[model samples]
Target: MDVKQVSVADKARRWIFSVHFCTPIIIIISPRLQILILAFLAASVSACKMNRCYNESELSEAVERKLRSHYHQPPDPLPAADPDSPSSCPVELYQYLAPHEENRRSLSPWRYVLRSMKDHFPSTYSEAECLCSGCILIQDVPGKGRVPVENFSYTSVPIIQSRVFLRRDLCGDGGKYRLTPVSQDVAVGCTCARPMST
Candidate 1:
């Protein structure tokens, strides 16, 4: 078996020259000065590591924190209405806003579209319930015997939509998270309307 021996000076020279901070000036400088410069560079590299990017788990936790800060909760349910008697349309306030609003309400899209193609993104979420959960309509079908059938009826129509931005600085200094534009449906008020299809 052949053995290779490396001396302390050789090891020190290899380490010092291997560093990226080494330059032509390093050769002209004194050994003591070179050691000091290398030490400073080592300290700087370690300092940068202190601000290392967040890992998967840490990033998830950070995103959750941002979401919790801007969490939007639905309003309390309205009192139950009489089943047999016709009830007026019910609505409640619903809002989801960012820490700082961008006031880009006009950017919201009316119908479904690709979020990436949207020019304006949501920074604030402000919306309201336009209609009830579900509506059923009874219709009479022509047959030998008159038979009544129930069909799903009403739906909440969006009058306006606001493009809003989700959490920003998701990763911030350490890391970054992709921001996808979101469209929020906004209904100013409630109304009685028929489905275009049904």
Candidate 2:
């Protein structure tokens, strides 16, 4: 063969060998790249799962603490009811009070107080036979007769006590109750005592 022809043929052979040799290396590396990508994806998924699990546990713990606190029995010797006071709301009621705009959709103060009393002090509540009276006004209504004030305050009285026995039992030492706001972000109160005023 001519020298030029021979040189051209040698060049083609080298090119073919280079391609043949490099092809397998590329092919081999592809699977390793895929494996690395898959490993990264799996790790990300596991991390997300772990985060969700942690959040759920935290939520459960918060709920459990709240339930325990709500149901726990109060310390002995309920506060004495002031005879002269026209309003006698449970201290717990203060916890329910917040900015009016935030609490517009919430349960009425009267309802919350009744529910708390029933749940926490069932025996005393049942025995006391408390009847939930509606809002009491300072003056008498034309047809509704004079509204007798049970609890009086500068703000609205959220609770009332009746002269007639609604429940015949005493509440015992479990009567002292306080309202605790759940979220610092939101203005809220429980049906217990007024913390701010006190």
Candidate 3:
């Protein structure tokens, strides 16, 4: 594209870049605009610090350690994190700000949007339960499973949903499998584990 073909979007980009080199324009702007700018800055800063929610390395290590302790043997040194795994879970900034939140009251409005999108799109997870024995991780039998739809008009359907909870495993025997059907409440999920791997 030639410079003569520059569109309004390009012009706006040029204007923004040119003004960014200037002094704090928010100071000269109206109070509402200044508050908006400050709120944005605060949100950005808060997002950068959201990793304090829970250290995955530490938490995963702890879970693994728990598994080892249950096995009645001193476990070896921690294994390296799966290098092929996806990036860590992204959480809102407010969840960790308070030491003891009652019922997810601190979440901002955007979290709802994120959650809705997550549900509507695609996801994979394993349900688990903590009984007197140990944590039981129950997952679907591996397949490219798809949802059966009665309505032909609806094109989008969920894929890979396990109808039976037959696969059961004690949490830390490196995916110890009992292969007995069961039910569970808590679901541990991520976009990383492959359909076959889980």
> Which predicted model would earn the best TM-score?
1
| Ten contiguous residues with the weakest lDDT in model 2 | 181-190
**Candidate 3, after superposition: displacement of residue 8 in Å?**
32
Backbone clash total, candidate 1: 9
- The candidate scoring highest on lDDT is 1
| Candidate 2, lDDT over the whole model | 0.32
Pairs that clash in candidate 1: 108-162, 108-163, 121-164, 122-163, 122-164, 122-165, 123-164, 123-165, 171-175
Using all chains and alpha carbons, the TM-scores for the candidates as numbered come to: 0.24, 0.16, 0.19
Which pairs of residues clash in candidate 3, taking residues 3 or more apart in a chain or in different chains?
A: 145-160, 166-181
Order the candidates by TM-score, highest first: 1, 3, 2
lDDT of each: 0.38, 0.32, 0.28
Who is ahead in TM-score, 2 or 3? 3
Regions of candidate 1 where Cα sits further than 4 Å from its true position:
1-57, 73-136, 144-175, 178-183, 186-192, 195-198
lDDT of 3 by residue, 63-116 (tens): 334334432222222222233333311222323435443112211111111111
lDDT of 3: 0.28
Off by over 4 Å in 2: 1-107, 110-140, 143-198
> Which ten-residue region of model 3 has the weakest summed lDDT?
108-117
